[model samples]
Target: MEQTVQPCPQCGTEIRTDRRFTTWCSACDWNVDPVEPDERPGHVERMRRGIAHRYGERLLAEMTRGESPRPRRDVAGVLAYAVALCVHGVTVALFVTGALLVTLGRGGAPSVLGAFLLGLAWLFRPRFGRLPDDAPVLHRADAPRLFALIDEVAACAPTSGVHAVAVTAEANASVSTYGVRQRRLLTLGLGLWEITTPQERVALLGHELGHFAHGDTRHGVIIANALHSLNSWRYLVAPIRNPSGLEVILNAFYLLPFLAVQGVMMLLDQLTLRAAQRAEYLADATSATAASTEAAVALQDRLLVCGPAEALLLRESNARQVRGAAKRDEPGQGLWDRLAAYVESIPEGEYERRRRVGVLRGHSVDATHPPTHLRRACLLARPAEPAAVRVDAAAVAAITAELADARQVVARCVLRG
Candidate 1:
């Protein structure tokens, strides 16, 4: 791999850059964000992004000015809950009706109809969250030190303890409830986890656990299941394209129900959007509280560069394959080490340029989250807080050792993809 040194266009600093990746000045960040945002979102997506941007800006302003109100169940929330209740009520009614028909109906036709209704009821049943079957699951016994760290962050977050941890190959981390009992589960993405410092790890945990502490309605069983049911309905009734004669008539018949389902889903999304955004802000505050303001902000900075990190991984995988060096038995060998080194090599100027790009693009972890810039601003706007949970080098080392096997598994998965 040959690297050429050249003077930066923006500044006279000489820098070395690999030809495979973007060539940018490390000192002046020249051409760091040369690519323009090319995604052209649809109308609904544009509207959603618009709403999020406005809300994020307003919230950031309010927080900075110390005028933000404590989140509570507002009209939208009440309406959302009522809609979710109605959704569940319909499912329950269908079940009851189907059961009665099946038990009491004397004729075969009635029994068949009842069975059909029962199937519909089953289709619309509330979905309890489940852990991904493929991801490596880590129990308390498997990773006591990691769980202990999570527990410490949980205490600092003042949230309920997580029941399990799952590791995946994504550049993100999240917490969600799973199963009938709704036990909390934390998903740690090695892409993000490997790059984070120990304190940033605490910030990551605190942010995830904060969803529980703040009672994020979007993740709550009621609203989540309702959204799931509505989505199922939408999928079930959606009209197909390129229909033949008979299918055309059926498609026309299905159109009304599809439209109705879409309307309901949109209404539910509108109701929950505000609450979800507020929850993110609150969660970020929790991250700051647990890991200190500086670490939380740094975590946001890391998030801004996740795109590049992922691209680097993809490039590495492709390059290895091209060189015929991607061994089956040792797939993704040294992948994590390479990724960590790449992240460490990113210059501060590069980080700053990415932050500015984030602001320009209203970049967020997802559509549900506020812009990364706003999140960072909100954290900086507040008074700096000391870390409530700390992780020393020994703790990090122990956690790393605990996740060593899972890391290998996830690394292989990433490379294989």
Candidate 2:
């Protein structure tokens, strides 16, 4: 189905999506973007009541119903399904050598193996491929700012390395892959710096470091890589045979095994995702405990508005930029052509669910973070604590330091590789 990018209900501007995640809107005071959320709580008082302990209890209970209650999905659903599909596909083939002999040729076995390997390669692309070498590293002068901020927070958090950081307006931060020792990345968007009060920004960083502190960052990356690899193997043939033009056909084939796995990895991924989500909650609480309630609330407000606004701005900006090229549906196209394009756009239920979670909740559950609204709800509902999230005099100094420490080592390596 062709989804007409709708206009933002709030701002009446068009909605847009790219790269499957929300970014920023330049027009509003709130950084706008999209994901999903419960219909607004009507008014502040009602929200306060609905999100109160009694409501939280009721909401929590309902939310947990039919949920694992005691499920474990360290690998998440898709990845687990991918793994199962791989095993079962191999087993079935082994059992029926006759079918293989009759239906396919010598290359079949190698093809399967090659597909699996391709999936595996993409899964760990970071480890083998040059790291996103272009990922911004804080400059030397900025290093003190980032480090000092990290260190101050590290007093509460364990050591977290600064492997890479970039500029985006997603209100996002991340920790890097796992090894003997853990390195981290802190991506700060331009909007994050421009709009947020220094204290709130620090609190946001603390929330990120808290993820590293809890060890969720490293674990999540492992699971994410595994999931990507499995998908690679399952969808290997389609990419080569038809590319994305027949993406729907490809994805259906890809999802067949996940359905059979009956949600093995789904449970695993949820557990990990919830862990990360809770960590953020604690981080928010930590920031509140460390700093002021205002900073906490400020962060939440900014985050809540970020998705919808970004979506709006993206549409407006791109409209002017790409108006001439917008594909008008051609009625004369054959079914195959229509099917090819439409299928590419439609994602599995799981992906759709994830998108809704981000839109409504600002989270893809398996992801380490949740949207700003849920966080604000949790924080505001609970008792308040005080910490500054640490916007020190050093923030100005950090500007220079973050810039000074930048490098291009990985970008160069990827070119050579």
TM-score of 2: 0.52
Estimate candidate 2's alpha-carbon lDDT, on a 0 to 1 scale.
0.47
- Report, for every candidate in turn, its global Cα lDDT versus the true structure: 0.83, 0.47
Which digits, one per residue and each the tens of the lDDT, describe model 1 over residues 1-417? 446678888888987765645677757657776886577677877877777777777767777786542567899999999999998898898899988888888757777788888998999998788888999999999999999988888887686678899998788999888889888899998889989899999999999998898889999899988998898898898887888999899999999999888888988888888788888888988898899999999999999778878888888678657766447677453898888888887766556766766766783335678878888888998889899999988988899899998988888777766
- The per-candidate count of clashes, in order, stands at 0, 47
Candidate 1 residue-wise lDDT at 126: 85
Estimate the lDDT of model 1: 0.83
Worst 10 residues of 1 by lDDT: 324-333
lDDT (tens digit, per residue) of candidate 2 on 186-253 = 66654334345667676677666665655453245455554454444344433334557587676676
Candidate 1 stretches greater than 4 Å from native: 1-39, 67-70, 319-326, 331-333, 363-365
Identify the leading candidate in terms of TM-score.
1
Per-prediction TM-score to the true structure, in the order listed? 0.88, 0.52
Query: RMSD in angstroms, candidate 1?
Result: 3.4
